[model samples]
Target: MSLSALLFPSDAMAQQSGIKRIDLQRHDLSVFGYETVQARIDFEPGTAFGMHSHPGEEVIYVLEGLLECKFQ
Candidate 1:
């Protein structure tokens, strides 16, 4: 399964939680069986996501507001 499928919430969940995701770009790497995806996610005030895992490397950048994260 794709990383987005693993990490991104379903449409119903997103609508209920006031979360929006915009996929910016996707590309297949020159190396065999490798790919990269970039996306932007927006969350409403007081909204949060449950603990989740990604299938590959993940990076996050916050354009505004403070973000709290927990890792285990």
Candidate 2:
């Protein structure tokens, strides 16, 4: 399946849920002695983020959406 298909089963679902994403920034972590990335995310009702991973670390804060997360 395509990446978007893997992440979102349906385009209608993605749109209905108001899934908006912005790649805030990216940088070479060598200067910080660790590899990491960060960004701001917005999710509307019915939106879901598929299972994924990071190389080093990750942190997330809920700006909204009842602050729920699902994993498999």
Candidate 3:
């Protein structure tokens, strides 16, 4: 598994909550029988991501604020 950090915000956040996203880098790699993708999703947030999911596996780290997540 790989871990990553992001500050992605919702569309409404950009206009209403003063959020922004800065994509620093993105790439895909395959090794043996595994595939991996690396990306950066930077944002300035004044709101929270309501509901979301990603393909395969995901790891996230937050720099500030609080995160409430529900998985089913």
State the lDDT of candidate 2 residue by residue for 1-72, as single tens digits.
Answer: 011111222234344445654445556767566434445555655656666543454455655446555644
CA deviation > 4 Å runs, candidate 1? 1-16, 30-33
- True-structure lDDT of candidate 3: 0.45
Give the winner by TM-score: 1 or 2: 1
lDDT leaderboard ranking: 1, 2, 3
- Candidate 3 wrongly placed segments (more than 4 Å): 1-18, 31-46
Q: What's the alpha carbon RMSD for model 3?
A: 6.3
Q: Rank the candidates by TM-score, best first.
A: 1, 2, 3
TM-scores for candidates 1 onward, in order: 0.69, 0.53, 0.47
- The model with the greater lDDT, 1 or 3, is 1
| The best candidate in terms of lDDT | 1
Question: Model 3, range 1-72, lDDT digits (tens) per residue?
Answer: 112344333244335443454445444546454344433433444444456554456557655555555777
Q: All predictions: root-mean-square deviation over Cα?
A: 5.9, 8.6, 6.3
Give stretches of model 2 more than 4 Å off: 1-17, 31-35, 70-72
